[model samples]
Target: MKLLIVNPNISTSVTELIEAEARRSASPGTALTLRTAPFGVAYIETRAEAAIGAYATLVELAEHHAGHDAAVIAAFGDPGLAAAREMLPIPVVGLTESALMSAAQLGGRIGIVAISRRIRAWYRETVDACGMHSRLASIRCLDEPLADIGSVQRDKGEQLVALCRAAVREDGADVLIIAGAPLAGLARQVAERIPVPIVDGVSCAVRQAELLAGLAPRRASEGSYAAPPTKACQGLPPALARLVGREGHDNENEEGNS
Candidate 1:
């Protein structure tokens, strides 16, 4: 199966981070493609950035391959996930929701550590939308800047482990999720230090994408996702456009094979 992973932020580094984690966890036969915003939308540290990033993601999805077997919106906030699902017939999986659900299956209760203060509401909305709010222990933010988390010497892994400990001890959480697509590589490091299972949204989303694509006997309606949007899209990277068109064609071939 083929999956398109969309990182809402414009940071190519963040995109690479998520793609690497997805590759590590993906089933051997599954094919994965990664895409990101062409313009720089830093931090996604606030509600305003999340809103704009959502629109940008939708535009990218429209211009590119909605026809993949499934799509993973690789953002903890899941910025435009709902809108993407509504716009395309294909299943859209949110990293945050997928991670939390995975955590739920591992334990009775789970806690989330968001990337920033402004995203607390987004975290709550993700839990509520996934019907896992009752299982959520708490949502905490580092209150640190995104730049700091990305720094080499910042030791985000250790800090996240400490936060997870607080969630488990003070908040009574049995499972923990180190949220955000940008922090995809930090889970293993944190899990090693923390007693409970630590979930990474990127890995969770990839596995969920694999499951959803496998469960569906057939792909989405060709008229809906197989065809690219007729409306003009601006500022889309050439490479992304090619990837979308290629995936759409591959979907047609898959249909023909069946």
Candidate 2:
């Protein structure tokens, strides 16, 4: 089965990290295609950045989404997840949603360790949307500066271990989820030290993506996610029109010309 992992941020390094973790976690016979958005900031920390990343994600998907059995959004914020799912026929899974679902299935309260404080509210909203807010113990933030802001002082592995322990001891958390693509491999790094199951969003999302890819695609009924209305999109780029499936365009001609 073919799987596409989309990292919405512009950072190719983070995408590589996610690709490695995905390969390790994915089942046999799963072919993974990892792509980082060529536009947007290195990281999506705020709502504005998330919005930009989401647009970049859609652009990337439009360019390379064909033939993929399933797609995984690698950011913990899950930018453009619903829109992507609506646009694509196959399953499109988000890292944050997958990790929370996995944590909930593993039983008991869920603890989230995020890279920054700005993402806490967004994560909380996501947890609430999943109706797992009642199972949430707490969302803790690591007080480390971004690489662009300053030298990162705290070792990610150590911080993950300590924060996970604190979540268990102080917040009464039963399962811990390290929340972001940057924290991808830290789960395995501190897995032996942490008592409970430490869920990495990247790995969890890839596993779920593989599972969803193997299943029959969802049937979009007449009312539910119905076909988009046919109309000409004026005052837009030709590529954008083709990307969104706008009317009055010859796809074969466009592809052949390109």
Q: What would the per-residue lDDT of candidate 1 be over residues 1-258, giving only the tens digit for each residue?
A: 889888889878788888889999999988888889765485476667888888778777766654577888888878888667645545679888899879988999898876677878867876788899899899876766555434522446566667789998999889888888768867865566888888899999899988987887454446454534434445655534433443364544354335
Worst 10 residues of 2 by lDDT: 249-258
CA lDDT, every prediction? 0.75, 0.79
Candidate 2 achieves a global lDDT of 0.79
What TM-score against the true fold does each predicted structure earn?
A: 0.81, 0.89
Displacement of residue 117 (Cα, Å) in model 1 is 2.2
Q: Quote the positional error of residue 214 for candidate 1 in Å.
A: 1.2
RMSD of 1: 4.9
Error (Å) of candidate 2 at residue 157 is 2.0
In model 2, what are the clashing residue pairs, if there are any? none
Report per-prediction Cα RMSD to one decimal.
Answer: 4.9, 3.9
